[model samples]
Target: MGFFNMLLSLAAKGAVILFFLLLLAFLGYCLYIKRIHMKYDHIPGPPRHSFFLGHSPTFLQVMKEGKIIHDKFREWSEEYGPVYRTNVLHFVFICVTCPEATKEILMSPKYPKDKFLYKRLFNLFGQRFLGNGLVTAVDHDLWYKQRRIMDPAFSSLYLRGLMGTFNERAEKLMNKLSDIADSGTEAKMLHLVNCVTLDVIAKIAFGVDLDLLTNKSPFPEAIETCLKGMVFYIRDTLFEFNPKNRPFINEVKEACRLLRTTGARWIQDRKTAMQNGEDVPKDILTQIIKAASKEENMSKEDDEFMLDNFVTFFIAGQETTANQLGFCIMELARHPEILEKAKKEVDDVIGMKQEITYDDLGQLIYLSQVLKEVLRIYPTAPGTSRDVVEDMVIDGIHVPGGCTAFFSSYVTGRMEKFFKDPLTFDPERFHPDAPKPYYCYFPFALGPRSCLGQNFAQMEAKVVMAKLIQRFDFTLLPGETFEVLDTGTLRPKSGVLCSVRHRKYSK
Candidate 1:
């Protein structure tokens, strides 16, 4: 009985020790968070909702309310000036909407992409998605090398050569839309544009013929699922743990696998073709393989990097352009006057022409303005972020180092300070006589790391848009709100549903 009592007493003492240890750890964590909070105390921002979670709860509330997170940033920008700080958990993000700050941050290579953010993009739902691709590569040297290798494929001369492919793919879309128009059926313009862009990227970049408009392919759905998964995975830290999210998460993983596997098969085919001395187009895929061919035998890591670029080009090349076209259509449909003017321009420049040439693209000046205005309003790839490793003063406000600096075109483009009547969609803002927006307008982003496919995307977009306006007259279906959906990239929330009718001059 004495020994039993002693054992109980010892166990009680051990429990007390463990409890104290946990208490000490908690106290230490609180002190660390306090230090971080003190570090950014000078920057103006909304009040934190939680001592530990920082602004994360507020962000969650915004998401729950079905609003784009960037719109919240814009709201905060209005309240707290152009440059303000936001805390997501313990991480500090200095949101800069002013043109001066935008120029300083984006135009220089000194600020690399935020590793914290890009690393999250390296995988989605624990599946490798963009593993060290040109987009996700944080290392400047690595990105530069890959960019150099891929530059030839995007050269002005090379892109000029791709006009034929663009016309061919876009013509397929017209065929599909014609079917919808004939039956008087409503069409999802976003889906149709997505297929055309997918077909274009497959043909021009990888030299594959997906013919997505003609063939029902899993790729479109897979791409959509992966994009949706990317939003959930990147925004919510605990996304994978929730039982409710399991089914969607599984689909995301499967979608990622499909893209990577497809990339692998296509890559192997190209390599085999090269081995057999068969003629293969000198395309982006060829450059991707060349980028990783420094070693006699490619390592597993090299092979994965090749796949990373394959997925990156496919998603980035296809998704952003399609979203832009969808939003452009949405806006044009909303304003019949603007649609009429744009159609007139297309009719004059590309009348009765089966093919839209590179020279013809340059002559579509008003249409170019319309497309530019669309991006200003709905920058499909909304923003870019940089890691601020050194302290600096932005707009005379002291911003501390060791924070992420985010430059959003969406916020800046809509600000009253940057553009008059920011909410009004005015194509005249991009007129040749209008003074150019300093650094406030970057739909394709600005700087050394600007989208490599900016011209390619725009060229493809103009062809599709010109043909679309020339051939069909479309009206937004009733009940469409034209809300922007932020699924990684911005897209029309209602899928840009529209009813189409063949124009009198279509033939």
Candidate 2:
């Protein structure tokens, strides 16, 4: 009885000690958060919702209300001026929309991509997504090495060579759309364009012919699932932990696995072909493999890196261009006058031309302006961020070091100060005679880290869009607003639904 009493006493003492230890840890964490708040308190932002949550609650509210988060950022910019601070829990972001800040942060190599943000992209639902890929690589030397190797694939000569593939893939889309046009069925322009871009990237970048428009494929759905997952996963820190989100999180993991496994199989096939001395096209996959071949002995990490580039190219190479094309079509359909004007230009430039040549793309000047305006209004990629490692004065605002600098083309592009009557979808904003936007317009982003596939993407977009306008007259289906969906990348909420009729001249 005496020994039993002693044991109970000792157990009670241990419980007390554990409680005190936890209390100290919690207190320490609170102090750290307080210090961070104090550090950036001088910066302007909306009032915090709570001591612990910071602006997270407000952000969640915006998401819950089904509004594009960047639009909210633009509103905050209007209220607080161009440079302001926003916090989500302990993470702080300095939003900069002015031209000077944009030029300094993006033009200079001094600011690298934020590791905090990009590293989150390195995985999705516990599956490796873009691990150490060119897009997610935060290391300067590592990214530079990969960039140098891949530059040849995106060079002018290489892109010019890809026009045939671009036209072929886009022609397939035209055929599919023609079928729908005959049936008088409303077509989802976003899905159709997505298939075309997917096919183009598969053929030109990886030397695979998915022919997604002709054949049903899981790739399109998988890409959509992964993109949707990315938005939720990256924004909400506790998203994966929620019991209700488990199903979606599982689907995301499976989608990621599908992409990576497909990449693995394709990569292995290329390796076997190379070993057997079979002829293979020099493509982005070739560059990806070559980027690693220089190493004496390839490691598992190196292999994963190759797959990373595979997934990155497949997603990044296709999604933005597809989204842009969808938006362009939607805008053209809205303004009949603009549609007629653009169609006339396409007729003049590419009339009865089944195969659009590289030279033809350059001659479609008005079409180019329309495409540029689409990007300005709806940059599918939306924004880029940088890690500010040193304190600097941006537009005379003293920003502290160790904060993220966010530059959103979507926010700046819509601001009235940057573009006159920014809400108006004016293609003339990109007219040849108009003065170029100074440091304010960057749909493909700007600087060394700017999209390497910008030219490739635009070339594909022009071909598909010009052909679309040349062959068919489309009208937007009624009852859908011009709402944008932000699923990692921005896309039309209504999928750019349109009814098409074949033009007599083309027939």
Candidate 3:
């Protein structure tokens, strides 16, 4: 009886201690929020979050079940205000949602790019070849120089020339889809996109032909493995204390090593083909070689960096485009009216033509708007970040140096003040007279550091959408809601399944 009484006493003490700790944590959070609010009390945001977790766990839970974080963020904004702070794993994330604040901070040189997560990829992995490529590197003169080196390849004339590549591959994609459509088979929709995007980038970036539509080879699988490779590092963020994480870091290194070896081989073969009087293709590799020859310092670095560029572009380029295209399709499939409107626009412009030429695409204003609208709804990336080099003030809020600044086109695109009927899929919102979405709806980002492949990605989407719509009218099957999966970019967590019927043009 005495021992039992002792045990009960211990349990009661443990419970009381836990309750006290919880109370103290709550008090700390209230104090922190109160302090932040007192100074910037006029600012806006959600209610006070947990001491360390902030609203991340709640938002992450919603996203895990296929809901968008933007919806919750906007709700908080309406209640709290546009500019507010939320903590994540002990880090307070200050969000600038007001359009004017977004412009002031993102465009300001004082607010710099943060290397928190992205740097681990390059500094830790085999990305040493980037030698200051746009995505991973800092915004410096050298970054600009390297960016300029690759710009001409994406220029109007160059992109127009690349249309032939897009056509051949897109037809292959249509034929593959038709086979599945005829047989009533539905594989992961994302898989088909990955294949086409790989084929597209292989041709455009490396000047190689990978008939991914037909090729069931391991090489493409290996290439895709390299692209899906980031999942391990991301997983590390969740289970940081796990000792197994080291193996993952090593695994990435080994993967990069293998990718680098294959890339070097491809480059050698391409160079040899060009040297032996063999007719070489006009593609991204050739463009890079030409640029390197003209530039003063692009070639002075270690050959591994150059070859790393090959692997980086080949893998990263394909994945980024694939993610964007997948999200676009997801949005279109969710909103059939928007899809039909786009189809109608395409039909009116090209008139049921089987082939979509560069010139034919030029007249697709509404089609272009549909693509833009999809991008706005689901940006290819969640947001871009910058580390403040010096103290900066956005709307009177002092952002101290060394603090990270994240500019979310994802969040900005959905802001109520920036977009009317923000959730609606109205492509007309992109028309000239429609309120301009300069800083508001930037999916490809803006300013000097914008996506170099914007034109290429647009052309790819336009061509693919036109061909698919011209051949097939798409509708969401029985029961499927368009949900955003915010991973590398906003993609459909579950593959978007649709019932596609051949276009008969009723009108």
Candidate 4:
């Protein structure tokens, strides 16, 4: 009885000390947030939805409403001006639509990626999704090193060699569409495009044949679940508490695990091949593995880091291009005259050629412009964010340090000041004689941190679109809405449903 009483007394004393320590920390945090709030007092934003939640409630509502977050940002920008602040809890994020501000922020790598967002990708849904890959790496020096090593994989020569693979995968899509067109059935172009892109990336990047065109690969649904979960995780702070979201949360976790596990197996096979002196194809896996092996601080963890790149390249290389192609088809179907013009260009350049050559790509300038216009309006990965570690003045506004600045391509693309009749699908905006959009359009982003696979994606898009336009005439299915869906990447809400018939002139 005496010993038990002594133990209880000691536990009480420890609890009292712990409570006081927490109290001190809470007080310190309050003071810090107060200082941050005062610094941005001049900037205008929506009134706090709650004293405790700030604007987070409204932000969450925007996300949950199946509305693109950037659309909401654009709406708010009209009321609050080009530069407006948003608060989520105590955190202040500045949304910038000003071209000058965007140019300054994106042109340099000094503004590191905001950790609050990027760090979530490092381990989301209690599973490592992107990990510390090139896209999610927060450390500037580390990302730079990885970028340098991976540059060769995306170099002009390397990409040119992959043209054959691009044509091959795109041909599979053409065959599938031909079958659909023969059946007189309306098809979801986005779904078929997704299949082609998935098959292309798997083959070219990893030397793995997914055959998504003929076979229903599990990767697409897995990728969709993972992406949806990530977007959910980003917006919903109380997501875990919702009983309804539990099953979905579990599915996302499993999807992430499946992706990482598949990546690990592929990486191991490559490593084993290298060890056995077997001939391995020159692909992204080979390139990054060489890079990983050369790291000065090589450890098991460093080797595992290559898996990050594997997952990153697979999703990044495929998803954005597929979304872009789907939107391009949707727009062309909507505007038949523009489609006819594009078809003329394709017919003139391709001339009954089944295979698209590198030289053939440049001559398809009109088609290229249409693709560019598509990107301008429907940038799949809409915007990017930066961590302003140091206080900086953007357009005469003093934005303090330790804040996040969001630059949106979607918001900037739609502004009437930048693009006249911004909502209209006009490919002529990218006509050769017209002036270039200065510092305002970046579908694949801009600067030193721009997407490495820009050339690869555009090249692949051109080949697929060239073959598509060369062979088929598309019509959007009736009652199909063209609403943009924001599942991390912006895709057509109705999946670009369309019926197709073989072109009369096609050989």
Candidate 5:
């Protein structure tokens, strides 16, 4: 009895000691985070919401409200000047909207991606999500190598070949919309657009056809869930500990597993075909595998990293373009005069044409301007962050090394200093005679790390829009809220609810 009591006493004492030690370590961590914030004291920004919580709550609120983060950013920039600071917990992010600073930061390879932010993307919920993919690769050398290998897949020749896939998938969507148009049923343009883009990427990139339009595929829903999961994992501090979030976290993990499994199956099939000495389709996966072989010091984990890119390109190639198309339709439905001009341009250029060729896309000039204008107002992936490796002066503000600098295409695109009547959706702003918005207008981003698929996305968008305009007249459904939802990537909150009908042609 005596010995048992003594053992219990010792265990109780150990627990107390360990708890106090943990308390001290947390205090130390808080102090270290505080010192980092002190370095940016010279910079102007909104006052932190709390000494302990910082600006994280405000950020969460903005996200939950379904308004674009850039809206709040614009307000802050007007009050705090072009360059300002914001904090989430211990990390301080300085947002620079000055055109010169934007150019210098984006154009230079010296400023690599912010390691802290990109690293989060590397592992979501302790699973490797975007591991060293071109978008998330922090090491500049590795990124350059990866970029070089993937360049051919996105080259002009390759993209021109993809025009057929784009048009074919787009035709499938128009057929689906035609059914809805005939029935006078409301369609969520974003959902259908997402289906078409997903099908296009699957067929073109992987040589696999996902008939998402015919059958309701779970892939789109899984990707959407994963995107929402990213926001939850990134923001919610007690994500793992909270029982309420466990189901959601599990769903995200399963989604990741599903994607990786699909990628593995696709990869294995390609390898089998190659080993059998049989003819195999030349696709993005084939190109990626070949690229990996050519890379010096290629590790056995090369295939795993390729899966990283599979998920990256799959999500990247589809979501942003779909969201952009949805927003373009919404804006067109709201503005009838602008819609008629675009419709007329499409009719004059395309006129019920069966194939939208590369030359035909070029001739749809007004439609091109309209697409550019849509991105100007609503860039899907709004901003990019860079790590300041060296001390630099940005717009007369001396920012220290180890600080994160953020540049928002959305915020910059909407600024009065960059665009006249910034809130207005004027396609005329992109007229050939009009001066370009310079550094302010980057829908696909700028510099060496700029979206390699910019031309590809633009082509895809033009084809989809041309067809939609050629076939149907769309009207926004009543009680639909036209707002942007940022679940990692910006998309329409209501999924762009609209009713479509076949256009009435004069005899």
Candidate 6:
């Protein structure tokens, strides 16, 4: 009986020891997290994580709610200083909003966007075609090299040459709309406009006119596949956020698989034409070909890589430009005065009877200001990132190595301190020699990685807007707002629906 009691006592003691050990383990983790949290404790931000999970669950929750994580960051930015930290997954994410910090990040030769996941996703799209094209596809040194090679293609003179593509597509789109409006009188503007933009991008970027606006289902198969293919990627990325002994990294051997398979076929076809010494129409793709041909290092193996750029250009230029048009047009439909101002400027310059020319559109300064304002409010490309190359101090916060930082034009656009009324769609804010908005309102971004197609894009927008407003006066069909689906570009949450009427401008 005494021996049995001794065994029971021993077991009780062991149980107590086990409980204390578990408690200590938990306490240590708490202290580690607490120490890190306190490092930024004095800095204004949202509530720190209550546990080690930090902002991971919040990010997934935000995604589940179909909202952008940046929206939450914008709210936090109002209270926090220009630079603040938010724990995103295991990351101590730093967001910089001030102009100085923005310039430091964007213009720095060292900082590049952290595109680890995007690189893999892009590779799935086609690694070869996008191997070195701008925007997350290239490393910093390659980006600089690619930028230098591509700059001449978008020179003022080159941009002038591309204006006809916009004018041509806009005319076709207008006529198509006229036919539609004659029959139905009103239609969803999003898809039709997107089709036109894609066609235009295809033409300007590569000189291959798919005529997507007129074609019934040109990019249908590829677009569908590309869209669906991204799901596997998003799923795989979220899976990596778990810290509990997750193993394996996928080296997507086909960085340009789809792109190469499909894109290379086109590149091969184009090369054959060039091999026969045929005149490929002068487009951005042709320009790239010219550069490659001139490049001593370029080889047949590089064709897939070059074609990746064309695909990237197609996705990048077309997608963003299309969304911006929808957003701006929606804003115009909502605010009659803004639309009228745009119309007046167009009419004043081109005068209702004249065909809008690229050169003529440039003379319409007030119209340009309106577009600038639109870009500022609903920029095509919203937020961007920069990974700190070395230890750096941003906004007095000393960031350590491997820290990724960011600035959102989307967020900056809404800051009360940035603009008098940041949310309002007032074009006059961009009058020539306009009072500058603290250099923080970067829509196309600035320096180094600024949108390569800005000049071409602006030309396209000017022509499209001029022709569009002249032809149709749209009313937002009562009780409709263009919802937000902010991503690489901003878009209508539920599509910009409107009642369209053909405008007859009286002389």
Instruction: Give per-candidate clash totals.
Output: 0, 0, 9, 0, 0, 10
Worst 10 residues of 5 by lDDT: 231-240
Instruction: Assess every candidate by TM-score.
Output: 0.94, 0.96, 0.80, 0.95, 0.95, 0.84
lDDT (tens digit, per residue) of candidate 1 on 296-362: 5557876777789899999999999999999999999999999999989998899888999999999
TM-score of 6: 0.84
Q: Find the 10 residues in a row with the least total lDDT in model 4.
A: 295-304
Question: Per-residue lDDT tens digits of candidate 2, residues 341-400?
Answer: 998888898888799999999999988999999988999999999999999998778999
Which ten contiguous residues of candidate 1 have the minimum total lDDT?
Answer: 289-298
lDDT of 3 by residue, 1-507 (tens): 999999999999999999999999988977775564454334345655454455656665664665666666666666656656654553445665666766766666555556665565563344342334567656566456666767777789888888788888888988888887787766455678788988888877787777877777455555544444453343234533567665655654566666677778888887788778788778887776667667765454534455756766766666666776666776777777887887778878878666788888888988888878777777766677666566566666665554455567777677667787778878888885787776776776666666778788888888887888788756655666666665545666666776655667666
Predicted structure 4, TM vs. truth: 0.95
Model 6 per-residue lDDT tens digits across residues 164-277: 778888888888878877886666777767888888887777666677666775353454344334433433345545554132212232323554565667667777888898
lDDT for each candidate structure: 0.90, 0.89, 0.68, 0.87, 0.86, 0.70
> Which ranges of candidate 1 are over 4 A from the true structure?
1-23, 291-299
Task: State which candidate has the highest lDDT.
Answer: 1
| Predicted model with the maximum TM-score | 2
RMSD of each: 2.5, 1.7, 8.0, 2.0, 1.8, 6.9
What is the lDDT, from 0 to 100, of the residue 408 in candidate 5? 86
Candidate 2: clashing residue pairs, number: 0
* Candidate 1: residue pairs that collide: none
TM-score: which is higher, 1 or 6?
A: 1
- CA lDDT, candidate 3, residue 442: 70
